[model samples]
Target: MDVDNGMLLCPTHDALFDKGFISFNDDGSIYISNKIDKREYELLNINKDIKLNFKREQLPYIKWHRENEVQ
Candidate 1:
């Protein structure tokens, strides 16, 4: 939703991002593992530390939710 990144989110599972350029399925769901790639991996490592910091800044809202939730 910000100006820096172009990411798409799945409502069902807010943990996943459509960074692979794939849209939602007919059932309105997405499987991220099937879309993982070198760029995503690199982005993960690069963003891991940041994701650990200010989680709300991450694209996937579920990540922030999980990061804030108490187990």
Candidate 2:
């Protein structure tokens, strides 16, 4: 993970983003549950409202469908 930019880089799968923080679910699925600071939230809101693709560069983690892997 790139600590400076808060970009998470999973080696087992592809999933990256500039989130304030993150947590994993029981099913091994990653969910964005970051609580942004007031100032940060404002900026994020602006980006979201403008439909900016922040996660565009990140590949989604699609491991559930793999028959050998079970979370």
Candidate 3:
């Protein structure tokens, strides 16, 4: 995999992401899957306000992940 295809995340968030419970918008904001209950957001420490800094080259990978992995 290309380095740009990788993102550094905490174990909890990483697992959530890998499980398709979360993704990200092109603007870098977090995209929580509807499959997740609203209450779980607080329990998981996730919120709509969260965002990551992404490079332009990473957008394509992000798009692919969102399409294929995210619920």
Candidate 4:
């Protein structure tokens, strides 16, 4: 586990993110969670076109998170 290969998501987002229920694109755009209820957007802050502050090096980790952890 590389320390710098991690994301800075909030606790809620982190849980989903790590499990690949949520993810980000190569350009750092967020991937919405299908499992999460749309009505709970305000509580989870789910939004379209959301860009995370990620560096290029974090891409591999992001991909791994998406591919290996997706439900």
Candidate 5:
């Protein structure tokens, strides 16, 4: 795996991401899976307002995750 193919996320967010509960749009906007309950958003401290400052080189990896890993 490439070193650039990684993101720095907290444990909770990391787990959620690993499980395909979250992703990101090309613009870096957070994309929560439909499978996640609305109520759990508050408990998980995640919201639609979250965004990432990602490099252009990371887009390919992000795209792969969105297309293959996200729910």
Candidate 6:
């Protein structure tokens, strides 16, 4: 479904991003869905310091994912 609006993410992050369980900012700071529990996030063992590299063009795609698919 991603076509031109895609990036190469690690499997965990990729799935999470596609499902809208996670997202990235223009600054590439990662954010988890508020629906996710703290314990669950801790158990996932995602890197607390990880950041994605996003370009301006990707904003619309990411926004569409967040607005339409995100829980």
lDDT accuracy of residue 38 in candidate 2: 45
- Rank the models by TM-score, top first: 3, 5, 4, 6, 2, 1
Whole-model Cα lDDT of every candidate shown, in order: 0.36, 0.32, 0.91, 0.76, 0.91, 0.76
Q: Model 2: per-residue lDDT, tens digit, 1-71?
A: 63222233443223213232333333434443334354664443323222212332232322222222222
Question: Which regions in candidate 1 have their CA more than 4 angstroms from the true location?
Answer: 1-20, 31-71
lDDT tens string, model 1, 1-71?
56423343335223344233223222324323434574774554323222222233343544433344313
- Candidate 2 least-lDDT 10 residues: 62-71
Q: Kindly list the per-residue Cα lDDT of model 3 for residues 1-71, writing each as its tens digit.
A: 78999999989899999999999989999999999999888889887798899999999988998999997
Better of 1 and 5 by TM-score: 5
Q: How many pairs of residues collide in model 6?
A: 0
- Sorted on lDDT, highest at the top, how do the candidates line up? 3, 5, 4, 6, 1, 2
Q: Least accurate stretch of 10 residues (summed lDDT) in model 5?
A: 45-54
TM-score between model 2 and native = 0.21
In the range 28-71, model 6's lDDT, one tens digit per residue, is 77777887787787666666567877878888887777778776
Alpha-carbon TM-score of each model against the true structure: 0.21, 0.21, 0.94, 0.76, 0.93, 0.73
**Each prediction's RMSD to truth:** 12.2, 11.2, 0.8, 1.8, 0.9, 2.4
**Which lDDT tens digits does candidate 4 get at residues 1-71?**
77768767788888778776788877888777678777887787777668877777788888877777776
